[model samples]
Target chain A: ELKVEQNPLFLSMQEGKNYTIYCNYSTTSDRLYWYRQDPGKSLESLFVLLSNGAVKQEGRLMASLDTKARLSTLHITAAVHDLSATYFCAVAYTGTASKLTFGTGTRLQVTL
Target chain B: DTAVSQTPKYLVTQMGNDKSIKCEQNLGHDTMYWYKQDSKKFLKIMFSYNNKELIINETVPNRFSPKSPDKAHLNLHINSLELGDSAVYFCASSPNQGTEAFFGQGTRLTVV
Candidate 1:
């Protein structure tokens, strides 16, 4: 069984600050995904890192995967107040069905 | 048009009631999944179906049943719902077994 853990479960930063949330998995999987969820809303897919060095960015959010290290990072660049939400990283294990194991979410609160 | 839609965005019922949530995806994906998000916001996979066949059931209680009439539709039915069953249920579909998934808006179930 693969377990996923994330650090800084709760984050509070200024509107202009930058931060990165780290996700560490127990297995050696190359497929990782980032998702965002707001209050009372379903998850929104942020990035999918398929390969070892895959890095994707959208707006102020960037995600990267390092299969060798069993780590994935979600970096928030110049965060804004609207970006306050919970972020989750899920690792996909390929089998008959790709089982996604989600990590402990990081709740971000961007303030002035 | 909504890529994925779930009916009854908000569901509030007393404990020991029975309810069902319907989900439909227009993306023509082959694999669909049911995920439960608790109040603490821990999202866990409950069941998965591929082409109207069951794929995964993560040790969930037997009271929760998933029916997939077709490839594009997956519905969740819960019998004898309990207080602990109060959570948000989301339906998601992917193009393939282990690929990018698009999620529905989610159905919030509240058991009082």
Candidate 2:
């Protein structure tokens, strides 16, 4: 079974601070995804890392994937109140369908 | 227009009742998935279908049944609902096994 784990399950950071959320998987998967979910809302796709060393950045959020190590990371360059949400990293193993195994989400709370 | 959409954004019902959640995607995707998010915020994949064929079924209870009538529609029917079944259910789809998925607004099921 493929397992995905994330660190700092809950993060509380002040605005303007920087933090990184780590995602580690138990199996080899070239496809990794990052998603953000606000309170009482559906998940929103953040980044899709398709290859080892692939990195994507949008605004203050950047995501990178390392397939060899079975790890991925979501880096927050500068935190803002708007960035407060639960972030999840999912690993996909290609079979008949790309089954996604999501990591334990990191709930981030950015305060003033 | 919403790429993916789910009916009954919120549902509240008594235990032992049966309920169904409907999902539809207009993105012309070939794969659809159902995920459950618990109160603790843990997300798990319950079922997946590709091209109207069942492809992935996780270790979910038999009471939870998923039906894909077509390539664009997937419905979940829960029989004998229990308190533990109370959670937010999200429906998502991707173009194929190698692309990023688009998620629908979740259906929050609350069992009393």
In order, what lDDT does every prediction score? 0.91, 0.92
The digit string of per-residue lDDT tens for model 2 on B5-100 reads 999899999999999999999999999999999999999989889999988888899999999999999999999999999999999999886468
- Identify the candidate with maximal DockQ: 1
Q: Is the docking of candidate 1 incorrect, acceptable, medium or high quality?
A: medium
Q: With candidate 2 superimposed using the best TM-score fit, by how many Å does residue A82's alpha carbon deviate from the native?
A: 0.7
Compared with the true structure, model 2 gives a TM-score of: 0.97
Give the per-residue lDDT digits (tens) of candidate 2, residues A1-112: 7889999999999999999999999977899999999999988999999999999999999999989988898999879999999999988886555788889999999999
Residue pairs that clash (backbone atoms under 3 angstroms), model 1 = none
Error of 1 at B93 (Å): 0.7
